[model samples]
Structures are given as structure tokens and as C-alpha cells.
Target: MVPQPFPRHIVDVAPSVGSTIWRYSDSFGLADPEAAEARLGLGEGGTPLMPGMGDLLLKVEFVNPTLSFKDRGAAVVVAHAIEQGAERLVCDSSGNAGTAVAAYSARAGVPCTVYVPAATSNAKTLQAEAHGAYVVRVDGDRAAAADAAEEAVGRGEGFYASHVWESSFLAGTKTFAFEVWEQLGRRAPERLVLPVGNGTLVLGAWLGFEELRLAGLVDEVPPITAVQAVGCAPIVAHATGRHFDPAPTIADGIAIAAPPRVAEIADAVADSAGEFMTVDDVEIADARRRLAEVGWYVEPTGAVAVAAAGQLGDRGGTTVVPLCGAGLKWPGP
Candidate 1:
């Protein structure tokens, strides 16, 4: 079956009176009656947008039910799978996305299988296992796990709920932009700093804000800074015409050496008058520690945007950063 198209029009419907992303269901372009009935949310989205270090504002995405922002997309993906009469769900991740798909699949009463890189964090793997998902540890990088999951789908093991390839996932993540706009008094922020691995959030934000702009809710899409790990920064390298050899880093979440949507990711950033930046493992650790001291304990990957924030030249605008995952996801220093 063909993938659902990304939503464009924002209907003039009243927001639902809750914190769940289903509150914006009408905007996601799901069918009217089914939109109300097919809401499978565990209170994802509606995270706090609070002031952070200096002039930065932190969007605390780790407050999600799964302790990461992946909940937002996973919830919708599972619902779509159920709508398609899927008997089982399959996905691949380094950690957070698999855990999210597992949790949401559990909620939808669907069996799930998650494939993860062998080096995935124990905390994340345990979470998926606790959700009763059969976990397979692939012996290569993130892409190998993805290949395993796709092979499972090809063998009819389950529907592919890929966070990287699924358009429905982007539809769900667009709620991040919606919430950000609402939190800032129905206006887009001057800029958005986000961690990029597969560019799910970056593309989602682009789609969301563009819809808002088309609906006349905002003047234009905000500039986006896509942050990546210095050790594995294909997007940055692509943008700057630099060659980078893949290496291991503490920021495993953004350690994708070859993201499937690399070109689209670069276009989104450039379209928004934005740029790419990379931070090393040392910088990530320092940023994580600083966030901990400020009572926002985010994982090293989650701290990537924060680390890049300091390197940004004084653009003199309201900059927002997203802390994408919880510190507990990776307890090691």
C-alpha cells in the first residue's frame, strides 16, 4: 500500500481539551470520524516549553511516557498499523524508537518485534522488553538493524513501522511544531535547534510549520539548526562538502552515518535559512552535565542541540532547543 501523504491543510477545528497529540488529530489529516475513534495515545506531546541557559528555551521532550520524544510518532504509527489490520508490528532502532514502538504496540494490543544494534543501551532494550516486544540484537550499526526489520516485514512477520521511512510518523511528529507554536502564543519561534539522526524531527518540524504558514497561522517557517555528532555527521558533511569517517560516539541517537533522508534533511535546513553543526563526544558530555546541574537530565544525544547552541553566532532571536531523550536512557559517563 502507498504511504499516506504528509498533511498540508490545517482544518478550523477546536483543539481537544487534553495533553495528548490526538488533541490535534484534525490537523493530521486522518479521516474525520476515525480521527476521533482511532486515537491511541499515552499522553505524548504537550511537553513543557520553559526558559533555559541564557536566551535559549528548552522543549522538554523527555517527559514523554517512554522517556523520549519518539512516543509522539510511535503512537500514531501503531494506530495506523491497527487501521490497516496489521497483525504484528516491526521496527528497528538504536534504542528510543524501538522502545517507543514497543510501548505503543503494547498499548494497541498488538504483538511487536524490535530490532536494535548490538551496542544499544541496556536501559532502552529493557524498556522494550518490559513492553513485551520480542527484541532482536543485530550485530552491526543502526542500518543493519533496519535491514533486519525490513526482511522481517518482507517475510510477513509484521507491518514495517519505520520511524525513518514512514510518512505517518512524520505526521505524528509535526505535533511538536504545533505545540511549540501554541506555547509561544500561536507564533513560530525565531529558530529551532534539534538533534538529527534520521531527520525525523527536522522533517516533521518543517512539515508542521509549513502547514501553519500555509494556513496563515505563522508568517514563515523558522530557521532550523540540525545538530549531529562529530563522529558520525553525514548531514553536516553533506552540507559543507566535507568528508567524515564514521566513528563511535556517546551520542548514539544521532550517529547515523548515512541517513536515508539526508538530502531532504539538507533541503529543509537550507529552505529555513539554517545550517548544520557537529559536536564531539566531549562537548556532548559537558552539555549533558550542565543540563544535569540545571535539573534537566538529558542523554548525551539529547544534549547535542545544547552543545551546538553555544557555537551559534548571535542571531538575536528566540532560539528553542529540544532535549530529545532522558538521561536514564544512558546512565554511563
Candidate 2:
């Protein structure tokens, strides 16, 4: 069967809002009558939009059910899997995505297996295992884990629930923009600063705002600043035509040396009149600590956007940054 195109139009339904993405299920176009009958969720989305350093607002995504924004996408992906009668799910991640998918898969009563780089933090791996997912540690980097997971799918082990490649995941993530628009009084922010690895959230936010724009809700999409670790900033390197050698960093979540959607990510940034920036481990550590002092305990990767916001200073209007993951996912010394 040919895959249905991702739904875009808002369906005619009662306009009642709730705290979860399902509140706007009609707007997201994922809650068809049949899918809604067997929908799966863990109360993802509708996270707080609170104050941050200087004039920046923090979209507290770490408060998500899996303690990361990945829950938004994972919830939708798993629901799609179930809707398609998938018996098992397979995916790969450095940390947060694996844990999210595992948790959601468990919630859906489907077996799951996650592949991760051997160097992934124990806390993240343990989280996935705690959800009863079979965890496989690949010996090399993030890409190696992805390759192994793909091979498993190739061998008919399970449906590939790739957070990186799944459009349904983006459908769920688009709620970030919707929630932000609602929280900001149905208006779009002047700018969005987000950490990028596989560009899931960045692209999702763009897609959401574009939908709003097309629906005559927002004036225009906000400019997006995509942040990356200096150790593994392929996107920034691509933009600047500079050579980079991938290295380990405290912000492991954004340490993607070769994101499959690198070109799409670049185009999203450029189309929004945005720029890319890199922060080293030292800066990430500092930002994480600073946020902790203010009661936001996020992982180093989560602090990446905050770190870039500090470096960028006050440009103008409202700038929102996302604290993407819980610090406990990788408690550093």
C-alpha cells in the first residue's frame, strides 16, 4: 500500500484545548477516528514556557514524560506503529530518543529493541532497559548504532521506528510550535534557539509554524538558531565550509557527526534567515550549571541553546530556547 501523505489541514472539530498534544489532534491531523479509537500517549506536550536568562524564554521540554522532548515524537511514532499493526519496534539513538521510544513502546504493549553507541551514558541506557527494551550497544559511534538498527529492520526484526527518519515523529514534535504559539497568546516568537543533532525538533518547529502561517494564524515563521557542540558541528561546518573532526562532548545528545537531514536542516535555518552556532564543552557545562542554579536541571545538550542564547546576546523581541533533556540523563561531575 502506498503511504498516505502526512496530514496538514485542520479537521472540523470542537475547539476544546487540553494539556496534551491530543488537544490539537485535529489540528495535527493524526487523530483519525480509527487511530483515535486506539491512540497511544503518555501525556506528552504542553510543557511550560517560562523565563530564562536575560530576555530569553525557556520552553521547559525536559519536563516531558521521558524527561526529554523526544516523548512528543515517540508518542506519535508508537501510535502509528500500533495503528499499522506493528508487533515490535526498532530504532537507534545516542540516548534520549532511545529511552523515549522504549517507554512509549512499552506503554503501547509492543516489544522494542534500541541500538546505541557503546559510549552512551549508563543513565540513558538504563532508562531504556527499565522500559523493558532490549538494548544493543554498538561498538563505534552514533552512526554505527543506526546502521545496526537498520540492518535489524532489513532482516525483518521489527518495524523501524526511527526518530530521525519518521515523519510521524515530526508530526508530534510540531506541537512544540503550536504550544508556543498558544502560550505566547497565539503569536509566534521573534526567534527560536534550538539544539540540533538529527534536526528533529528544529524541523518540527518549522513545520508547525509554517502550518500556522498557511492557516493565517501567524504572520511569519520565526528565525531559528540551530546550536551544536563544537566537537561535532557538521551543520555549522557545512555552512562555513570548514573542516571538522568529530570528538566527544558533554552534550552527547547533539554530538551527531553526520546527520542524515543535514542539508534540510541547513535549508530550514537559511530559509528562516537564521544562523548556526557552536558551543564547546566548557560552555555547555557552564550553561548547565547556571540553569541548575535557577532550578532548571537539564542535560548538557539541553543547555546548548541557552549557551548560544548567552553568546548571541539580546537581538530583539521574544527569543525562546528549549531545555531539551533532563540533567539526570547524564549527571556529570
Candidate 3:
């Protein structure tokens, strides 16, 4: 008998209401996030791993529920909390993650309060407000916002839906790897290229592939290649033998001066046989422009992967990249 096709994990879920997938191990009360997503027409993980520059398979995650890849995590995390009888949700997000949490929380009839830094772009802050999030314009920088949120969470003001530290979100995000493996006909990818702000995607994909391997689904975890903007690349510096300097960068989405999950990010990088690289702000801008020409409107940070993928020298065939966020999330043109 021939081997069954991969991605068949949901073959019987019908993807509609009253549908159920196999034992996909719903984490964070999102046991059915994928199913609920398919029915709601949120356009979840079914993103095209389409061909792109250098014939790479690019997963357009920007096409998610809130126009950024964070929807995967937000959807699962928020919905799970709703299922758990949670009332209010609090989060600290610069742009993408905040917007995602707001939208998903609204879907679940939960009040979402987001704390964004003073430097957060008007576009993102407005989007958060548009999604009915209690957008609190905090003072200081992104790191400061996290601290403020932490303090508030510690005070039991609300349930802190930390995008970085949420294990449920990490599990939901990892589905990207399973989808990628299936899209490639169950063949392991040559590489997984992406951008690292909070290192959410990298960690998710790594965990997902590990689960798949344990389930006898895949043979190995694909190599991860995460790229960061030179302006703020603490993880890259930590991984590439460079000095750690938490400077600001134009890629505000990935301008994580200090990520709460630093050690996990570093370990995930090494375990996946991955290497983190940094690119200049100018190069990021150029990728954004070029992607726009392809009708790929992504934020500067989202394009960092394209910049890094191009530099990888084409040895790894069938590269998988994700456009982590949409351009509309950026400030005014």
C-alpha cells in the first residue's frame, strides 16, 4: 500500500461547523482553532506555499485573519481563553500581535486591552482601536510597554495574553511547519526562513516539527533561518558572535530590544540547525518595495526574510518563507 498524503490530519474535519479534526492535540482551548478557522472563513493556515524568488515556496502568512501571521497564535490563544471562562484579556504588543489579539478577542466576545509603546506607529495603534481594543498609549519604548503590562498582569488587572510567552500561541504558530511539510507533499523543507522579533514563529515551527516527528509524521526538523534588522537584533547578535546592543530600527515590528523568551529563542535556533542573520534597514525597505511589486504588501520586518533568503546562496532547494505581517499595519504611506 502507498503512504497516505500528509496534511490529511484534517481530512475528516469537513472544516465547517460541527466538523472535527483528528487528534491534532488542541492546545490553549484551541483544540478546534483550525476547524473553527476554516468554518469562519478566516483564511487560516491554508496560505499558499507558492513559488517566489529563487523558486522558493513562500507561505504568505500575512493573509491571515488580521493580515499578519500572529493570527495563528492569537486565534488559538484568545479562543482558548474564552473556552476557559476568562473574562478580560490584556496584552502588550507593538503592532501586529496587538491587532491580532484585539480582533480575535472581539470574535470571542472578550474585552481586549492592549498596551503599545509611544513609538508604535499610528497605523497599528489605530488598527488596534478599530478592532475595539482598549489601546493604552504607554510612555517610553516597546520594552517599557512590556514592563508596564507585566506590572498590570502581576496586579491581576486582567489575563495577560503574552504573545511571546504563551505556550498555546506557540503551539498554534507551529502548525505552520506541519502545513509546510504537507504542502511540500510531506517532504521536509530545505530550510525555514523567517523574521525574528519575539522569535514566536521560529519557536512555533520548531515545536510543530518536533511533534510531527514524534507522531511519525516527518523525519526531521527543517533548518530555520531567521533574519533580523540591524537596527534591533538582539537574538541575531546573541546567535552570531556579535556584540549585544539594543538599538532601535525602522523595522519596528521586530524591534524587540529584549524579548522575554530569550533563552528559549536561542535554544530553538541551535536545536533546529538554524542560523540567525541581520540585515540593514535599507535592505529591508528594498525588500518591502520589491514585494509590493508582487502584490506582497508586508511590513519592513516581514520582508527581512526575503532579504535573508536571497543571501543564502540557493544551495537549499525548496525554501519556505513566511510574510509575517501585512503592509497596512504600517504607518501612512
Winner of 1 and 3 under TM-score: 1
Comparing 1 and 3 on lDDT, the stronger one: 1
lDDT of 3 by residue, 1-333 (tens): 998786635345444432111124354345565555543224456667777555677788887778888877777777666656678898998888998889877766678899999879888888888879998878998888888888888887788888977787886688787778777898778788888889789889888888878888877787888788887888877777687556667788888888878778888878888888888877888888988888788888788899888788858577888888888877745
**TM match of model 2 to true structure:** 0.92
TM-score of decoy 1:
0.92
Which candidate model has the greater TM-score, 2 or 3?
2
How would you encode candidate 2's per-residue C-alpha lDDT over 172-242 as one tens digit per residue? 89999999999999999999999999999999999999899999999888999999998899999988787
Candidate 1: Cα lDDT at 266: 97
Question: Over the stretch 186-274, how does candidate 1's per-residue lDDT look in tens digits?
Answer: 99999999999999899999999999999999989999999989889999998899877778899998888789999999999999988
- Global lDDT of each model? 0.89, 0.89, 0.78
In model 1, where do residues sit more than 4 Å from their true spots? 1-17, 32-39
Which ten contiguous residues of candidate 2 have the minimum total lDDT?
29-38
